[model samples]
Target: SLANAEKSQLEKELEAEKEEVETLRDNLRNRDKMMKDRIAMEESNRQEAERRMGGMSKKQMQSMEERAKSAEEEVEKSRKLVAEMRMAYTVALVQSRFLRKAMEKLNLITGVTKTENQSLSLRLSNAQKDLNKMEEETLNLKEELAKTKEKVAEAEEKVTHMKELVETMEEGIEER
Candidate 1:
């Protein structure tokens, strides 16, 4: 009688714990789905914003400006969602790691572990390279703009000098 009662109580506790795990799994799944959708939408919006940043007609600029603002807002939302998801994922991963450690202690099989360390490292290296390229591009654009401005100022100075010479010649003729 005592052994059967203990077994029933243990089964009830196990069932409750299983339900809790399932709930957390469901939450993690939903968060992941939302994160993926938001990232995809934001990627498109970001591309549009980048295109708008390039040269355009005045009217086109005005339209792009309005769209850019809206897209920026969307990107902000996406960033926030991504941040929340990253936090959630970190927490979940930590929990899973703890559970795996516990299972190891209890002599149970461990869940799958990441085996793509090299792949991850390579991707990060590539991302760094892309960042460097963008930085160089921005620097080149700034230098070009500075040179163009200097040329415009030089042209303006030349025009002013010509106007002064014309006035001086006209005054000499008047005096003669």
Candidate 2:
């Protein structure tokens, strides 16, 4: 049950990570396409302005040039943003790989720890059994010791009675 819980949690995390990676990739691709389209549109607008400028006044020409310069600046900014986004995507990819590897190692460690715990549990059970057996043996030994003590007490009583009879016989012999 512990293994299953851990595995499911890890799976959820991995799935979430994969989703994040996919989202980043999609965003990068969309941004790249938008940048390309913006650049192409800017180029088309510049060409159209040049074609119209042939009959335009000096001030109008200067305004047209300023607008083109502004558009170019916007394109440059977009390119830089795309570059930064690409770098972020790369970093995310690397982080995902590392996380996957870490998860795998964690799984392995968890499995090993579970096996070790089971082994320790078995050993503890065996030790308990051995302790119970030893306790039983101790109880039997105590019972035998008690019985031997009682026998010794009975033998001592008999020896005392025999000694008294011998003393009486010697007294009788002296009197005679």
Candidate 3:
């Protein structure tokens, strides 16, 4: 029963861990998709700026360059965030695997312990039964011993009565 309880608890924890891993994976995928979309949008903006720069005034061109620089910085930041997310995903995956393996090992150990506990319980039950039988036999032997003592006392009384009768007969013969 203890083993079953422990196994069930472990299974629940494993399930929770699996759910966490799945959630993390979903989050990572969503972030990756968003990052890709942003990169594509930045690329399109750069192309449009290039097209405008050809016929634009000096100040307009300078403004476009600044916007382009700002876009590059945003893209770099997105890349860094994606890299961090990937790293976090990898760590979560490794940790999930480790927890699964540990849980499996714990389940195995619990099974073995349950088996051993059952075996010991059976052995203890059998030993108790044997002890009860021995005690009963001892009680029977004690009763038999008491009966034998009574019989011995009766035999001794008969032997004394016979000795007195022999003495009385001898005394009567001497008087004759």
Give me the candidate number with maximum lDDT.
2
lDDT of 3 at 17: 47
RMSD of candidate 3 to true structure, Å:
52.3
Better of 2 and 3 by lDDT: 2
Instruction: For candidate 1, write residues 106-156 as lDDT tens digits.
Output: 322322235543443353354345434433433443343344334334433
Best-to-worst TM-score order: 2, 3, 1
User: Candidate 3 lDDT (Cα, whole model)?
Assistant: 0.49
**Candidate 2 to truth, TM:** 0.49
Per-residue lDDT over 1-176 for candidate 2, one digit per residue giving the tens place of the 0 to 100 score: 67556645755655565565556545545644654565566556556654663355556545544654555455455545545554554555555455455555645565456786575446445544543443343344334334433433443343343334334434444455
| Each model's lDDT | 0.43, 0.50, 0.49
TM-score of each: 0.33, 0.49, 0.47
Which pairs clash (backbone N, Cα, C closer than 3 Å) in model 3?
Answer: none
Candidate 2 RMSD computed on C-alpha atoms after optimal superposition onto the true structure: 51.6
- Top candidate when judged by TM-score against the true structure: 2
Model 1: lowest-lDDT 10 consecutive positions: 103-112
Off by over 4 Å in 2: 1-6, 112-176
> Residue 163 deviation, candidate 2, in Å?
99
Q: Give candidate 3 misplaced runs (Cα > 4 Å).
A: 111-176
